[model samples]
Target: MYSKVAITGMGIISSIGKTVEENFTSLTEGKKGISTIENLETIHKDVIKVGEIKLTNTELAQLLGLSSDNNYSRTALLGAYAAKQAVQSAGINAINEYRTGLISSTSVGGMDMTERYFYDYFKNEAVQKYITAHDAGDSSHKIAEYLGLEGFVSTVSTACSSAANAIMMGARMIQAGKLDRVVVGGTDALAKFTINGFKTLMILSDTYNTPFDNHRKGLNLGEAAAFLVLESDAVVKEQNKKVLAYVSGFGNANDAYHQTASSENGDGAFLAMEKALQLAKLDISDIDYINAHGTATPNNDLSEGRALIRIFGEKVPEFSSTKAFTGHTLAAAAAIEAVYSVLALQNNVVFPNLNFQTPMEEFDLMPQTTLKHKEIRHVLSNSFGFGGNCSTVIFSKN
Candidate 1:
């Protein structure tokens, strides 16, 4: 059996809240964060709702103590803000004191700035500095610099599953004895390009996203960042850290079915969940709650529902998707949901799936629509992304 990786700290900044406690409060209070776009200047501003952070880019930079002249993209700003909070929460005075690393994921690294300066780069030298911050690894490096981490800094950009895969990779690195501790998560910011891209696909919901509902429309694009500090057992014991939860299991699989749609049978989803259960050394019944990857899109809810039935038969544990609360955070969806899973494990409560009224026409999959108190020992969180990327991470009480 692989040694369990302990999650000592977690931080998140989303539409619902800025801190972990705030997010928990929002969840418990049934506060929905989805609303019409306010930060990004998009043509579809009136037609599409998004879970955008209320803070402006300048405000975020101020929170990070970045100079006005710095080329910090919104993605980097959000990532650094949340990662620093995670470090502080873990009581990490010196990040380099341990063999530390940072694994961040983002689909839109600096696109928020690039789209704004795509035409001004040649004429304006002031904005040219952001050109180098346009790649996927730039945000990860910025987050590492913010945290004073030097070794094994990397990034993943497998679309929406990016953060879950980052968490999975962090756990594997710890199990393989490569790093003593790693901060894993993802970040994304609202941008006109992404909004238009989703609009072209016709999945941007105009109102609150109702996950798993028969009348469900599409997803509400959101901007947020979240990070978790994963430490090995040795490091946990040596540092006398307060363990919050354990990364007991993780699995990833690809369906190769479509570029933007999951397979009809959710093959990748099933395999990923099965593999996670096997690694956890726990039976399917041990998963007391599921934070499903319920994006509320017609295809996703159908496919994910089928996958749950395949794995759990008729005994699927209580499950719900918190996307309605925070909107679909794209690459950060899994990371934010991972934080929610840890919160559920720590608090022993099943977060409500928010905004579901009708069952699907094909399946009897009814999500937990109200926050229910239960003995949540284990939580299974799923995040399925484009290009058939499917991932599952299981968290247990430590």
Candidate 2:
């Protein structure tokens, strides 16, 4: 058996809140963060809602104490903010003292700035620095530099499941005696590119998203960042770390690399959950709460619902999707949901799946529509992305 990687600390900034405590409060209070587009100038501003952070790029950079000329994109700024908070939460003054590393993920990367300066690059040298920040890896590097970390730094860009994979990779590395501790998560900032891209796919909800509901429309694009400090058992014992949770298991699978739009038995999601249960050495019933990847889209809810029914048979545990609270945060979806999973275990509560009135006709899977307190020892979080990327990670009480 692989050693369990302990989650020493976590940090998050999303539409619901800027801190972990705030997010938890929002979840417990059933406060939905879906709102109108405030920062982004898009044509769908009046037609669609999004889980957007109200802070501006300037405000974020100032919060990080970045210089005026720093080339950090909005994605990097959001990532550094959350990562620094995670390091601080973990009580790590010397980030590199324990062979530390950072694994950050992003789908948009620096596209927020790229789209803004795509035309002005040739005429304006002032915005030219952002050209180098236009890729996914640059955001990870920026996050590491901000954290003063000098170890294995890598980036994962598996679209929506990016952060879950990052968390999985970090835990595996630590269990394999490759690193002592690692910070893993993802960040994404709203961009016209993504907003318009989803709009083109006709999945942007005009009002609140209703996950698992039959009348659900689609997902609302959102931007946020979250990070978790994962430490090996030895490091936790050596430092007497206050373990918040443990990365009990993780699994990833693809449905023949996409073409899963028809469910096909939720091939990828089913296998991913099955593998995660096998890795955790737990039965399918051990999962007390499920932070579902319910994006409120017709395809996703039906597909994921079918997958859950297939796995649990008649004993599906209490599950809810927090996406209605934070919209679909793409790359950061799994990271934020991972944080929510740990919060559920810590507080012994199941967060509500907001804006649901009716269950799907095809399945009897009705999600928990209100906050329910329970003995949540283990939580299974799912994140399925485009190109058939599907990932599941189990977080357990430490």
Candidate 3:
């Protein structure tokens, strides 16, 4: 068995709210953050709604104490903001006190700046600085620099499942004694690239996203950053840190069945969930809630619904998707959902899966459409992404 990986602290900036407490309040009160695009200028502004963070690049840059001469992308700025919050919440005076690392993930590292300066980079020397920040790993490097973390920095980009894998990797590293503590999560800012990408897929919901509903249309794209501080049990005891929850189980599997589509039978989802249960040494009956990866996309809902049925059979726990409140946050989805899962465990309350109305015709599974009060002991959260990547993480109340 691997050493326990405890989530000591977490921070998030999403459409729903700017801080972790703000987000938790919005989530429990059934507040929706989906609205017309505000920060970015895109052609699809009127046609689509997104979970925008409501902070401009200039505002975020100011918060990060970056000068106008800096070239930090919106993704990097938002990531630094959340990461700093997590570090502060953990009450760590010296980040390098123990062997530490940072594993961040991003699908659109700096596309927001790239799209803005695509043509200006050649004509404007000031804009050329952002050119280097246009890769998958640049934002991660910036986050590590912000936190002064010097060892074992890496980035994962498995689309929406990226952050979950980052958390999983951090846990494994601690288990292998590679690092005593690690900051892991994902970040993505709104961009025309993703807006049009999902638009092309015909899965952009014009209104609110309703997951697993018969009348569901599609998903809303959102931008946010979330991070978790994972430390080994030994380090936790040595530092006397406050343990928020334990990452007792995690699993990752690939369908390899399609590039972006899930199997009809949800084979990849089933494998991922089963693997997580196995790692946690818990049974299906142990899960008190499931934070589903229900993006409300027709294909995803059907496929994820099938997977839930296969895993839980007739006694699925009360579950919901916070996506309705925060929109699909791409690389940040799993990380933010991890925060929500931990919140559920701490409060023993299951937040409603907003916009869920009717059950699907194919499966009998029904999500918790309204805030349900229950003693949530173990929560299973699923996050499936393109490239057939499916991941599941189980958080236990300690």
Candidate 4:
């Protein structure tokens, strides 16, 4: 039998909340955060809604107490804030005291700032500092430096599933005895780059996104970050850590079906889920809840729903998509949902998928639309990204 990776603590900043407890409260209270865009400068402001965080860049920097000259991007600021919370929650006085590492993911990277200074790069020396921050790994380095971490630090950019892949790697590393503990998650900020990109694809919804609904339009782009501390069994024993949950199983697969759309059959999603269940030594009936990758985009919801019915046949578990509460957060979607999954397990409550109305005509499946209270032991979460990257991780009550 394989050893289980313990999740000691978690942190998050989203349209829903800025901390784990706050996010939990919002989830249980059925509070929705998707609304009009406020922080971004885009022509779609009047056309689309997003789960944008209310804090400004300067405000976030102030929260982290960064110097005015610091080149911390919005992604880095959000990451450091959430990572600090995770480390503090884990009670790690000395970060390098243990064999620790940080694995962060971000598709937005510094694009938020890059887009703002795109035309002023040569004309303005003031914004040149942000030019170097315009990649996927820069924020990881900044977050590491901010946290005083000097060990293995890396960033994963698997599109929307980036954070879930980061968590999967952290768990595999702990199980392989490569490290004693690790902080893993992702961060992102909304920008015209992604806004225009998805807009060109014509998937931006005009109002609230409704996952699995028959008349679903598309997804609303959002921004946020989240991180979780995963410790090995030996470290958990040594530190007497109070585990919030266990990382029992994870699986990732690529369907290579489309550049930006999931296959009609959800081939990658199916293999990912199947492999996760097998790794967890779990059967179809064992999963108590499913945090689906239901982006509400017509292609995604239909593809994911088909995958669910294919996997469990007629017995798909209580499933819901929290994206309605926090618009599709690109790279950070899985990380925040991971926090949501843990919250569901901790409180024994399944969050309602807001905005869902009529059941889809493609299948007979329906998501849990009301707050459901049940004995949730194992929660399976799925995150699929562009380029057919699909991932799933199963979290169990400790």
Candidate 5:
């Protein structure tokens, strides 16, 4: 009943890899990028492990060819790099050739600099230029300008689910015939503010994260940027583009239960998945694999596990959370997982949920612990954020 939106290009720069090919190789090799923090200066660096990308801010700026005096924050630098990859991967020589837009998401836009120079801004003039890049929309604008896109650029900041909502919005805009092609995803650089904020909640894991395990501690914060180029059928047909996957279903719902935790029953998550299925016109059985938003936090896994049982009853399909491999990327979690879902559909394999040793006693749910080969048709990806914001996106092989 709805027009299918095709995903033609994807680009990602995470702790595991700098490009799509490199990320795929890391996933296939069962490599985990979680480690001690190397970039951000934080007091908890000794105890907290994170999925920090190895590139420094200067190196990232160099990669984007920005001058030393450029006001681009670390967020903008990483976003521009990944977005440029997405545009290039999509094979769009002229960005404005067709009606194209960019929808990016970020939680801590430029806080890395803001927190660093909070007091020094009064005296230091050289670093004061970064003050303008502190807003959430500035990173999106920087990414758009770098990609040569001048149309319909916006940003979403629903915390962790921001990128998933961005992808959903891009798909809807395409379905509504508002744009021929659009780039949608999220970016966030590790910042002291976020690390300290999460620490205040007592969810920062000192060791490796173990999703769905009884002894699971918590999440390791990470920083990365990922983007997917979604185009309509007309654009794909006209250009004969290579369709990587189809954005068949997407939904968003808010539980409104708590500011940071999901409802005890995962009501918002269930509604989000139900809406996605309805849009896809597919049943629960059609989902071959699920890239869960298993942040490895006690509340998220328990709530999301309950939602799984509620949705599939006794026949839940194979599901795993790739968070352990890339740590919890906050806003970019869903975007990178969406890339992993497309990869699963293309390769017919499910990535193993690393660091799982014990199953939760609350349910019989067991994550995929090994890379298993199978014929995957539809892959479901869930992303639940703070303030009970829950989102689901389904990718189907074309």
Candidate 6:
């Protein structure tokens, strides 16, 4: 069996807030970050709402102390900003003190710049520096460089499930003795590409997303970056690190049922949750809360709802999706949700699932709609993404 991986620290920058504390406040207070686009310029600005970070690229560059000549894309800047917080939160002055690695995920690396300079790159050499930042892995490299990490750096692009898988990989590496510590999560900046992509799917909600509601229309795209420092038990003991939570369970499975649609019975979601519970060696009853992957999309809610019913039978615990507060952050959704889950465990409160109304006709699942205070011990977070990727992570109070 692999050794248990402990989450020492977490950092996040999302549309809701720039720091973990701010995001937590927004989550608990039912304050949403979704609004008209402010930072990104696009033709579809009026039609689609987004969870933009509201910081200009130049402002972010200045925050990172980069010169005007720097070629950092918005995604790289956001990733670096959040990763730096995670490293600092972990109380590590030297990142290379042990065998450390970084596993970051992103569906849109530098598309914000690519879309802006698609035609300008040929005419202006100054903007050509951003051409190399267009790939998915490039943002991870930039974050690694910013943190001075030099081992096992990689990126995963499983659409919305990217960060959950990144966290999963980080935990597995520690379990397998491949690395003593790893910074794991995902990042993505708002872009016209994703706004249009979800528009094409007819899953871009005009109003706030209503996950698990029968009248749910679609999701609001959001931008965010979050990272969790996963360290082995030995490393935690050696460094006297404070454990935020224990990543007790994790599982990833592909639906293989469709390219972008979940199976009618939520086969992949069911398997992933089941596998996670098995790995955690806990019964379903032990779970206190579920941060569901309720994107408010019609297909996703139906599929995920069925899966929850099948897994928990009749005694499912209180569950809610924080997407209403932060919108759907695509690849970074799982990572940010993981951070929210840990916060729930730490504070002993379950954040409300805003915008929820009528229960779905297909299932009787109703999400917690108010800030419920209770002794939270273990929480389960689910994140299902496009391309049939489904992931589940269980975080326990340490």
Tens digit of lDDT per residue, candidate 6, span 28-77? 88889999988877777888777888899999989888899877778889
In model 4, pairs of residues that clash are none
> For residues 52-96, could you state the per-residue lDDT of candidate 4 as single tens digits?
999999999999998888888899999999999989988888999
lDDT, residue 137, model 3: 94
Candidate 2 clashes: the total is: 0
Query: Please, what is the TM-score per model?
Result: 0.99, 0.98, 0.99, 0.99, 0.99, 0.98
Worst 10 residues of 5 by lDDT: 113-122
Q: Global lDDT for candidate 6? A: 0.91
RMSD of 5: 0.8
Per-residue lDDT of model 1, residues 1-398, tens digit only: 58679999999999999999999999999998988878788889898889989999999999989999988899999999999999999999988888898999999999988988889999988888898899989999999988888888999998999999999999999999899999999999988888999999998788889999999999998989999999988988898999999999989999999999999899999999999999999898899999999998999999999999999999989999999998888889999999999999989999998989999998888999888999988999999999999999999995
Alpha-carbon lDDT, every model: 0.93, 0.92, 0.92, 0.93, 0.93, 0.91
Candidate 3: Cα lDDT at 108: 89
CA lDDT for candidate 1: 0.93
Against the true structure, candidate 6 reaches a TM-score of 0.98
Stretches of candidate 6 above 4 Å error?
none
For model 5 the TM-score comes to 0.99
